[model samples]
Target: MNKTYDVVIIGGGLLGCTSAYYLCKNTDLNVALIERGMLGMQTSSLAASLVTRGRATRPLIDLCVETFEAVSELEDLLGDKLDFNHVGSMHVAQSVESATAIAKQTEMLRQMGDHPVELTIDQAREKAPWLSIDQADYIVFNPKDGFIDPYRLCAAYMQGAKASGNLDVYQSTEVLELVKDGAKVTTIKTDQGDFVADQIVVAAGPWINTLLQPLGSGAAMAPVRSHYWITATDPLYPVTSPVVILPEAKAYARPEVGGLLFGLRDQVSKWAHPTDLPNSLQGFSFDEDYEGWTALEEAVEPFLEVCPSIGKVDIHHYISGPSGYTPDGKHVIGKAPHLSNVFLASGCCGAGVAISGGVGQSIHDLVTGQTPRIDLTDFAPDRFGDFDPYDEAFLTQCAASRSQKKAG
Candidate 1:
């Protein structure tokens, strides 16, 4: 007989793990997490794991603050340390125009009750002597932003969910198809076998399209390649420093265990599946392309000017991964319009890690036919008007155009 579960969640990343944890701990549902490969080995592990509470909008700022608070105490709840470093974050603006924008953003943060300390070029240099403050006109520092070990956090959630005895996690299990009875998902067909479920949550990240295309829910999503680099550390460059973002340069860097990790947004963004995720783990012959590194180098040039010593830092290889994005910058979270028992949690862009906790709680509430903790009307999958395969090309073009203007 096929195994029966009250809820079957696809994708074992942070979203899936948190959903399982919340459902198993708070509800009476029997849950199972299905992953195509090892848990947290995909985009979840590749995430920069940045937690920031500063945003231009009120709702997004609230969400970030809520998530940061939740993740800060995760270790206390799980009885294991999450290895999060609350080094805060600094946003540096290169030009006068960018400085004005930063000033506006700082005001927005203040309105959101987060008073980010403004830093002059000299003050920023004093704080991080390795940065090139001469290239930047202004900097806004937020003390609440920080980074976390994404793999450890995912593992913690998985372990906690498993300990509840109400959850079963199937790693290396790929969902082949969704068996639907009219407008409801009745079973999930996987490589191992089939499992009947009362509810299904699709949080498959980049692979979400493949799983949902057949459902014909008029939902659209796009995947973009993102790359980051790590620099060898020295005693002078301590990990206590905050994560830094150079908005004018279209790059960001954060302090890691042994060094500083950085990445940039490039012009040539591709949209295709390489049959495997890009990285060392999959034994894929991947190397950092010229355009990506060039962007990173240009973005951090000002920082290096203020902190000239960092220019001599050893390079720690580059990383490239895909981020599933929606037309708008917000995530798509809600029940499928055509299927009553089917739910989706994709289109996160790069914000998935920060919002997974709240997303999990929202998914749990949605599955139980209760009101979500937040007003998710703006993130509904049905918001996309008439989606089609060719729509991806248009969406990708639009995203590329927007990025180009942003970088220009």
Candidate 2:
């Protein structure tokens, strides 16, 4: 293998793979992607894949719009199905605050071509018998929202990048350091020997700072613990049932075959610098708080308001992993703060899968000297200036962003 290339990407997760895909498809630059473990199996796969297009901000909404368009473009260009279920999304509000927000969102969404349908309590239950949201005072539905298989989708991006014959993937090759010279990063010192590239893109998710900290810089995002619960096969989670979002409950649920897949927001946060973060997550502990069980019990009490279902359902699995979140709940993309050759794509804000396309394509545009299709002003990597990402206060601010997110 050559030690030099036009571009070298660190991390084989969804962001890195997507960046490689667009670069290979849109440019002729030879590229290499390095991963510590298998591609896309880390935090990328652990996420509860929810593609909710309607967002709170216009720019975010536009990013979500570009995501759907990119999904179509990927399928059309590769002739491979992505299987993104556009099974609609139901936004349920149990409090006056949430109901007011939902009403406003529905009104705003209608102007943006969203044919949102207002659903009554009985109607919401009819759509998702597995859920008991009689406590909900407001409900709205958008048919364009849905979920996807995270692993398969990540694989597709990697495979498509390889189809160009210009991309090489090195799985299980852990990146050790970024050897910088002057203001540019010239060599990537990995466990599998050093490689050089004219340009480098760091999409290493939570581990991004491990390479940047030595350079006296870091991405302004915290790796918060994101987890979900999976239930055994049951007839209640019908495939036709739309994904339900409960903001006040800080929960969301979608069907997983005959079973149910639900994720709740943890008020508590987990934080660690990449240096302190464990390399393996197979048996890592996230149940630090004793409140988890009680929160689950209290949260499930509402589902039991209409049916005695969720309380008795046997949980088959629990998925927990890192998701990079910013203090302002936005993604951080664009050039690395002070590095001339390094580009960053971090701070997914719990919507990495949902907004991968826009982020990926924007990274491609930046590296190729072409203009990005979306406005990157709000997503500048260096917007926060210099701050200690490992600082407890900073991580807490980042945790606030995750706490505010209720959708999958």
Best by TM-score: 2
> Across residues 85-178, which tens digit of lDDT does each residue of candidate 2 receive?
9889999888888888778767777988889999988899889887665467789999988988878778888877887659988988988888
- In order, the Cα lDDT scores of the candidates are 0.71, 0.81
- Name the regions of candidate 2 deviating beyond 4 angstroms: 103-112, 135-137, 287-308
Query: Where does candidate 2 clash, by residue pair?
Result: none
Q: What are the models' TM-scores?
A: 0.87, 0.91
- Which candidate number would show the highest lDDT if scored against the true structure? 2
Tens-place lDDT digits, model 1, residues 1-408: 798998999999887887787677678788989998888888888887787766545555555565665565566677776766877788887788777866776788887687699888777756555576556677788887788788887887787677665888898898998878888888899999999998898888777766676776634556666667777877655778787777665666777776878766665555544234432234332344543466555445644554566578777767766776666666678887687888888766677777777777788789888987677877788886667633656457525632442210
Candidate 1 achieves a global lDDT of: 0.71
Q: Scored by Cα lDDT, where does model 2 land?
A: 0.81
